[model samples]
Target: MGAARSRILLDNDTGIDDALALAYLAACEHVEIVAVTSSPGNVDAEAVAANNRALLALCGQPAVPVLIGARQPLRVALVTTPETHGPQGVGYATLPAPPGPGEESLDAIDFWIEAARAEPGELIALFTAPLTNFALALRREPRLPWLLGKVVIMGGAFYHQGNTTPTAEWNTHVDPHAAAEVFAAYSAAAEAGLDTEKLPILCSLDTTERFEMRPELLTDLAAAAHCTAPEIVSEADPSGTRSGASNPLVRYLSDALRFYFEFHRDYDQGYIAHVHDFFAAGIAAGTMEHRTRAATVAVETESPLLIGTTVADFRGLWGKAANAHVVSWNDPDAGFAELVDRLGALARQLDPMG
Candidate 1:
C-alpha cells in the first residue's frame, strides 16, 4: 500500500537536526506541510522562523507559510542553550537579517490556532521543540483538541538519559508548565470521545533516539551535489562539483553535524547523530510503527534536577494523561535503511540533474 497522506503543521526550534529533518519532510510526498511554526528553545523563536523560511526556500517549497511562536514560556523567563546550538541559533550556519517585521506580532500559538482550525480534525501537529507554543495554543483556543488528528512530539525522556538537564529533555524542560497543560488538554479531549485515540505523541527518549541518520544519506551531501552552505538551494544546483567547492548552507549543515558527530563519537565511540525530529516526521510520513497503548505519562516540573521528566507506565497512574503514540522501540538498521531510501529518492527528485 502507498504511504498515507496527512496534513501537517510543523512546530520546531530549528536546531541542527531540525534543519535536516525539515529538509527530509519537505522532500516527502505523503506529507503536505501546511504551515511551519517556530518556538523558543535551542534558539529564539524569531531566529528559528527566519531559518525555517530559508530552509523551506532551499527545499523548493518556499510557498509554505512560516509562523513565529512564543518567545518564552507562558509564565517563565526564556531559557536558551548555546552550548548545543550556536549563539546564532543554527550551528555553523550564518543566517541573513530578518526578512521583514518578523514573527513577534503573529506568535506561535496564534499560528497553530489558524492552521489547526483551518483543517479542523484533519491536521497532524508535529512538534519538535519546547511545548510552550503547544501549551499556549491550547490555552488560547481550548477547542483545538477537537480539530487535530494527532500530535507527534519529539521531546521528553522516559528511560534514557536527558540531553539538556539531568531529568528533563530540552523541549519539555524549557516549558514544563506548558507541557503539563498540553498533556492535560489532550487527555481531556480523548476522554470526551473526540476520536482522539488516533492522537499519538512520539517523545524524544523513547521514540526519537531509535532513529538515526545513516552514513548512506550523507553520500550526496558529502559530494556537495547541489547547493552548498550560505548559497541557498533555490539559487544553485547540487549535481556538479565546482572543484573543491560546496554549497554554503550544505557546508554549514555538514560542519555543524560533523562537530555534533564528533561530540557523540568521543563518548559513544563512532556514534552518529540520530534524527530526533525525523522520528516525528516519519510517523507523519506514515513509515514508523506505532500502536495505542494504555500508558500514562507525567511531567515533573518541581524537581530540582528532574524538571519536565516524562515517566511512562502501564499501571495508569498520574490521572492517565493523553500521549499520542510512542515508538517505544525500533530496529535501528531497518529504520535507517528505510529512512535512507526515502532520503535518496527525495535527493534525486530535488536535484536538477537526477
Candidate 2:
C-alpha cells in the first residue's frame, strides 16, 4: 500500500525562498496542500497573496485558496527584505496575476481556525515566516495547539550567527512578541493536556544552513527540467540563444538566486543560497530524516539587543520542561539528494511529457 498523504496548511511570506518552498510542497506527491495563508514579511501581505496565487498556477494547482493575513507584525513597525528577495519578493520571476481575488469569506486567521477545526487531528501547520498570524490565531483559539496534528516552523538560530541581528533570526526578529506568544501558548496547551509527542517542531538555522544549494544541484535540477518539460525550457530561454539551458522552475530559481546568492556571498561570505523553509516542508511531509533535541525554547522580546533570540534551555536552568523539539542536526548529503529527487519529481508533475 502507498503511504498516507498529509494535509498541510502553509503560512508563508512568499519571498524567493518561500516561492521555492511552495514549489517543493506542490511537487511533493505525498502532501496535500489544504490551503495557503500569506502574511507580511519578506514582502507585504498583498504581494504574498499575489505570489502564492501565481506560483500555484505555475505549479498547476490554481484551485488552492490563497488567503491574505497580517499586514504587519503584532507589536512593531513593519520590516521587509527587498534587498534579499527583490522589490516584488520573487526576484526576476515574472508570473501572471492571480485569476481571481483572494477568498473574501475568511481571512488568514479565520481560515486557519476553520481548517484546523474541520480536520481535527489531521492537519499539519507549516510556518515559514513571521509568527504574527499564528500568534493571532492562537489568541482567537487558545486550544489550537491541541487541535493541530503537528506544527513545523522554519525560524530561530542555535549555535549559529543570526541573519537579521547579532542575536536573532529574521523571521523571529521581525516579530519577537508573536514568536514569544506562540511558544508560550504551545507550552500552556501542553499543560492543559495536549499531547507532548506532537509538540512544536523547529527547523532552525542550525540545521538548514547545512543544506546549501550548490552549483551541482542547480545543474541537476536544470537537466531534470529539460527532460520533463522542454517547452518550459524553451519559454524560459526566450531568445533561444541559451540552447535550452533552463526551464521555468530553473529560470525562476536562478533569477531569485542571483540576488540571494549575492547577499550570502557579500554578507555571509558564501556563493550558495539556502532554502530554509524547504527543510520545514520536508519535515512536515516526512521526506527527510533529522536529529532533534528536546529543549525549553523561549523567544526574547524584552531586550532591545536580544529581541527575537531563541533562548533554548539545553540545561535545566529555569526548571522548565521542554516545550519544543529543536532540529539540531541532519546529514546534508542525504538531505540534498532527497531534495533533488523531489525537485525532479515536481518538475515532472508540473509539466508532464506528451
How many residue pairs clash in each candidate at the backbone level? 22, 0
What is the TM-score (0 to 1) of candidate 2? 0.92
**TM-score for each predicted model, relative to the true structure:** 0.84, 0.92
lDDT of each: 0.68, 0.81
- Model 2: per-residue Cα lDDT at residue 87: 89
lDDT of 1 by residue, 220-298 (tens): 4534345342222211223211222244434445544554454455456354676687666776767766554555566
